[model samples]
Target: MIDETIEEIREMQTHSSSVVAVKATRALAELTERDYATVEEFERDLERNVGALKRANPSHASLYNALQDVLHSVQGEADDLDEARELTVATIDRVVETVETGKRRAAQQAAATIEDGQTFLTHDYSSTVMEAVELAVADGAELTAYVTEARPRFLGRKFARELAAIDAVEPHLMVDGATGMFLPKCDRVIIGMDCIVEETLYNRIGTFPLVAAANEVGVPVTVVGSGAKVVDDGFRFENEIRSPSEVMLEPVEGIELENPAYDATPVDLIDEVITDEGVLEY
Candidate 1:
């Protein structure tokens, strides 16, 4: 059952964005409800399952961190299966609550940075970024958003649709390659991060080039995400390589296709990272 749950998580992470940590925490909670003869058995199985999940998606540090919180929650308190189960559920609640609260706080901080009549450029689809923009519009900032049609998935199109639905903002969908052409006219760049390792922000594959273009044009770039996405020093975060079929459906003779799902952006290109705690200047 634990193995099956881990497989579900793997499938979910492949198609979803930024919700892997919350899903993993809930999966662990489900494990705790199952019947276990001994506490040792439960711990052993939990560790093995979490190890499998970590192997499945190494780019997301939040999964490992959330599972670790669950494991530590019952370290000395679980004398029986019921105690262990309760502790696991409690940990899941705390982790989810903390993540949601942090996102809300980060969104508010990000929104505060927006100015009236400014044109903001964004890439890919990020719930945190959307929330921040929504809050800024609510605050009476009449803004224009230049959204990239992030390729392979076109998640940015979805983001553009959401932004267009808002009455206070105007949204324009542009091809990813047009970033260089548009950056010079934009006031600022707002993006979302998948993980923060040291001084680098890992996000959608096109983000690095977008940041470079923004930098070349002297446009300030801000990243909005939860503090939980930050990784410890010396921890390595792998970039997930997606299937080439996502980029091309037909077979090409002797031609190779590369489809990297994410890319890394150095801190020098970023002006600020807004988190629940506050705005972190880079």
Candidate 2:
């Protein structure tokens, strides 16, 4: 049953929105309530399940932090399996509440950076980024958004549509390759991160180049995410490489297709990171 749950989580991580993936992963903590003979057995099973989830979506620091929070909370707290199970369930509740609250706080903090008559460039779709922009619009800021058509999945198109729905935002969709042409016209580049390792930001595959272009044009780049996305310094991190089928389905002989789902943006290129706590200057 645990194996099936992990498989379901793996699929969700690949296909669902990040918020959905995170909430679904938190639900897995309930597995602790199942029958177990001893606390040691429960711990072992929980660790294994969490490990599987980590391997399935290594780039998601928020998911890792949530599981780690629960794991640490239940450690050595109970002598019996039933007590351990209760403790794990309670910890999961706290983690979920903290995650939800943190996201809202981060969104508000990021929105503070937006101003009227400013043009912002963004790549890919991020719930945090969208929420921040929406909040800024609500505050009566007139803004323009230049959205890249992030290829393979075209998530940027979805972001553009969302922005177009806002009366305060003028949304323009451009090809991913044309970011350099558009960067000079934008006041700032605002994007969302999947994780932050040390000072490096990991995000959708095109983000690094987007940062590079913004930097070259003297435009500041801002990253918006919850503090939970920051991973410990020594944590081993790996990028997720997606299937070539996502780019092309046709079979070609003797041709290799590389589909990297994410890339890292060095700290030097980032102007600031806005999180639940506050703004962090890089």
Candidate 3:
């Protein structure tokens, strides 16, 4: 019964702006499907893992923030179901629609059109990229792109899978460890922001590296974010990196781990911030 409750909580978080939703869902799913002997046993393992998760990346803060909401429920604490559900649903729905909706698609299509026949590199997974690529494919634009795996969680797989479906979009899987190695090859690099701080952007954990590499290679970096990420002139970005234990988890004792949530890219590294409404040049 507790496992069932946990899964629902996992689902709730996964579908939110908190990207950890994906991994948390995976963890909870694994717990429920495998069936731990007791809540204490499960809670012990969860506390251990979540503790380690704090170090691997920066986004873990949000993951923990979202996880807190989950744990609160598991402990039988009551939440304002109507208000909470409404906020969660709206947050996720805006992000989803930001990626797949027609108005946003029109904007993406126009942005790509501004620089027709350009090759670009994008970091992590973005619905914005998918929409832009589809539009480019239909318009017969020469759009070759590179993607970073956005490691630990590897949300890049979703981006690659979706990119493959749209013919004419040449997408390369850039290894997280070696994304810098290929920077000079692309004309432009575009990243989607999970959060924008002041004018800076917080993307996946390794986004800082990509921005530095792009600047070194003299390639202009562009960002795509819904207006929401731009908080106060500068965007507020929270990068989450997950636990190193994600690399290995054993039922045995004496093992230590740390996971981080996300990373941030400064606004200076960005040449422009493209949104559905238009562009914000930083």
Candidate 4:
């Protein structure tokens, strides 16, 4: 079961970084149910599984931090196998709760930033962004959202479909390359973050260009996600190179198809970051 979860995360079948972390933490909690002979054995197994999950998606700081929090809470603190298992489960529960609550609060804060009749241009599929849009609409804020066709996966199509269902939001599907063309039509560029390492924000591959275009047009960019995405520790972002088949089913003989999953955008291009804590001005 844990292996399946790890594979789901690694294959990018999971929806978002927040969902991935929640799924991972729940998987770790389930691991405690298995029988173990000794505390040492339990510790080793826990470490192994945590390492595997972290490696599954190294770009997700939330997952890394969640696993590390569980390990630290359980490691050397339990006197027996039962105690270790208990500690691990408890820690996983706390981490999952914190992650979910943070996401909810952050989404609410992001929604609050949306003014009535504001036009927003967004990239890719962000659960937080989706929730924010829903909340804003529910609160009677009419909005227009331009969604990019985040390529190789076309996640933005999914986002656009969801936004279309909202009566108050006018959703427009835009090609990824046409961001510059659409920037003049937008009042703001609001998106989601995978993680922020220092001064750089890493998000879906097309984010850099979208942000660059938004900056050029003087459109304010707002990134919304849990503060957990801000990696302050030793966690580093690892770019995933997907199968060329994802870009094109038929491989070109001499053409090298590079499908990078994410790209780094300098924080300077972003005007604000909305998290559970509050709005952070860049």
Which candidate number has the best TM-score? 4
Ranking by lDDT: 4, 1, 2, 3
lDDT-better candidate, 2 vs 4: 4
Using alpha carbons, what is the TM-score of model 3?
Answer: 0.62
lDDT tens string, model 2, 196-237?
Answer: 888688888899998998888899999898887777664666
For each candidate, the alpha-carbon lDDT, in order, equals: 0.82, 0.81, 0.57, 0.91
Between candidates 3 and 4, the TM-score winner? 4
User: Ten consecutive residues with minimal summed lDDT in candidate 1?
Assistant: 9-18
Rank all candidate structures by their TM-score, best first, as comma-separated numbers: 4, 1, 2, 3
Estimate, for each residue in 16-67, the C-alpha lDDT of model 1 and write its tens digit.
Answer: 3347767776777667766778988888877776777677677777776776
Worst 10 residues of 3 by lDDT: 9-18
For model 1 the TM-score comes to 0.93
- Where model 3 places Cα greater than 4 Å from the true spot, the runs are 1-116, 233-241, 250-256
Candidate 2 or 4, higher TM-score?
A: 4
Cα RMSD (Å) per model? 1.9, 2.2, 9.0, 0.9
